[model samples]
Target: MTRTPAEPHSVPAELGPYLREVVHRARAVCGTHLVSVAAVGSVALGDYRHGRSDTDVTVVVDQPLPGRTLSDLAAVLTHPGLPCPATGLELVVYDAGFAARPSGEAGYLLDLNTGPLLPGKVSFDPAESPAFWYVIDRSVAHRCGLPLYGRPPRDVIAEPGRADLLTALRASVREHGLAEGHLGDNRVLNGCRSVLFCRTGHWQAKRRAARAVAASEERFRPLIAAALRSYERPRSAATELPATDVRTFLAWVAERVGEAAGR
Candidate 1:
């Protein structure tokens, strides 16, 4: 059975119009196959930064979408056609079966990445991308996703087991730490959020998680504070975080998550 969309007033004022446009375009393309549209990531977590955060969205369809429909949906929802208000739009579409019972692998019908921060690409094959990110995103969606077009997230999306989440978190930490070049504030704040989730089994806004971690972890206070400051500022105006400190913080967080998983 189809469900009504959530109230537009429930989201940030700036995003209300953009989201409405997205739903309109998606409905036009997918028609009856569309099952739900939900807001995830920073928006759903209630700490969305106007210029820095990407608008992360999840769409569920009744079954696998044909190639033509996927192309049509991507054309309308992506940049230029829809114009994302945030840094970009990271939208993923999953079949209802996969949304209800996601396996250990990446299983999505469409993965559309658009805007300035991310490379513009439309991927249909799961093999084209990494699996860990999808797993973690699903965990977050199941926990706190806000329905925009259909049934509540928890009703259509299943939560990954704690162990599986921890595994994905560990992989994420490693990937962030090992990557070369600018580590950025996201690494630090994501580390804080990952550790918080490992310990409490709940998702939190990056800023809130950084503050909470700073209050308790005195050793990482300076690092987290710097990260928070950078995160709050506009992406171009933000100061650079110390790469060494960010990597060190991620290592500590990984250890903490590993310990929690062992318990």
Candidate 2:
């Protein structure tokens, strides 16, 4: 079942060696049980930035991974052993059955969060994590994933329904609005992307989606531009958006997603 990546040439030059190493380590750990490896998120969307973006990857396996395998995977894939080149590496391993018929539920076998910007945690229990974010991630991966180790993504990953996506988007927008600390750039850009997805049911890079929203929603042009500027800069140079503007933007996006769901 294993084959060359569907679009091997599409991978960024800087990521080639790192991703290959990821595959090698994964294969060494899981052996024949590993079904495939696919690159998702900004990397797959062709908007990856060296110091600003996290590399998101999804791995599908023939069956649930044992505790020993999970431990070995964490030991080898996390920092020091197999250093991540990007800001972080957000890898999720899912059973093949769950991947083929996904739902708005926590069904992952392993949720590995590593790197500088991300929390260095490896989660195995579904009940211990929030389901909405993973649900949205699965939806995006199904639509935009680029295969790196096996069969094409669309063959193994099922796209969640429009209603499910809208529900997840609404929850995400609300969470951003209520969350504390510094997520200014993430809030505004995510708002832009959410609204665009609500209207079009399509996925685009955050910056690209912001530009598309800015073109149509004149009122949010300034906010969108600010978000874009902050997002493009290195992490140390990133700027925060006004809290009031971010709240308003998220509210508007949540309303839009709600409306889409009703329709």
Candidate 3:
């Protein structure tokens, strides 16, 4: 049932034309059930890096579609109907009720993520693990999410409270371990962003957060600088900071977040 992405719709110029076509194809397949389509993460933040960022998309449906219909929609998105501009897409289809409900679990009916690390392949999670990242994403979307179609992000996503967000951030760091390999840059930057958010209730992109903290926290300058190089540089030139340093940085971040959370 996989078909090519076609047609085009108006969206942010940064999303480019290929993605716009994919959006149109997705809507065509979903028909009346599709409620809203939004761009989250870096693309929505106006800081998307052509090769380094993933196109994070959230699709809301009025109700659960039939199994066949869901499969078709997935095919439309994953079939490489258009040349993807970034690494690839991390798409989630959510039921309208769950989307509108005041919960931060995501409650998605379908989840798919693919990228250069997983070229021409996708990971499907019908029952994704509980993570604070989802909560953070919703919060970002509520504040500055880009709507491609349908209702506004605020109406579609419930506002996650600061207390809950902090709790989730702490748990995420404790359990996920410090990410390694290509994810090392994001792991460090995200850790910094989480700590800053806990202290300031402000959301920031990874590079911005790294710079913000590194400016005032001289102790973390080396670690943050290395992360910035890896994050901003091409993958071939990305540097790996020593494992011990990464662990130390993460430990420091965890402690700061815990103290801020009063845990």
| lDDT score at residue 222, model 2, on the 0-100 scale | 95
> lDDT per residue, candidate 1, 7-103, as tens digits?
8777888888998889888998999888889999998999888988888999999999899999999998878767788888999999999889956
- The regions of model 2 sitting more than 4 angstroms off are 6-8
Model 3 CA deviation exceeding 4 Å by range: 1-14, 119-126, 180-182
Task: Give one digit per residue, the lDDT tens place, for model 3 in 1-263.
Answer: 22222223334455667566667877789887777777888867667776677888887888988777777877777734554666777777778777776564645677766555434533235445565657777787787777777777778777677677777788767653546234677778888887778768887877888899899889889989989988887655667777787788889888988898884
Evaluation by TM-score, superior candidate among 2 and 3: 2
Candidate 2 local lDDT, 1-263, one digit each (tens): 54765455788777888889998899889998888899999988889999988899999998988988988987899975687888889999998999899587778889898987766889898788878778888887888888889876778878877677777888888888985634688788888888888878788898989999999999989998998989988887889778798888888888888888899
Top candidate on lDDT is 1
Separately for all candidates shown, the number of backbone clashes (residues 3 or more apart, or on different chains) is 0, 0, 0
lDDT of 2 at 241: 79
- Candidates in order, TM-scores: namely 0.95, 0.96, 0.87
Native-to-model Cα distance after best TM-score fit, residue 58 in candidate 3, in Å? 1.0
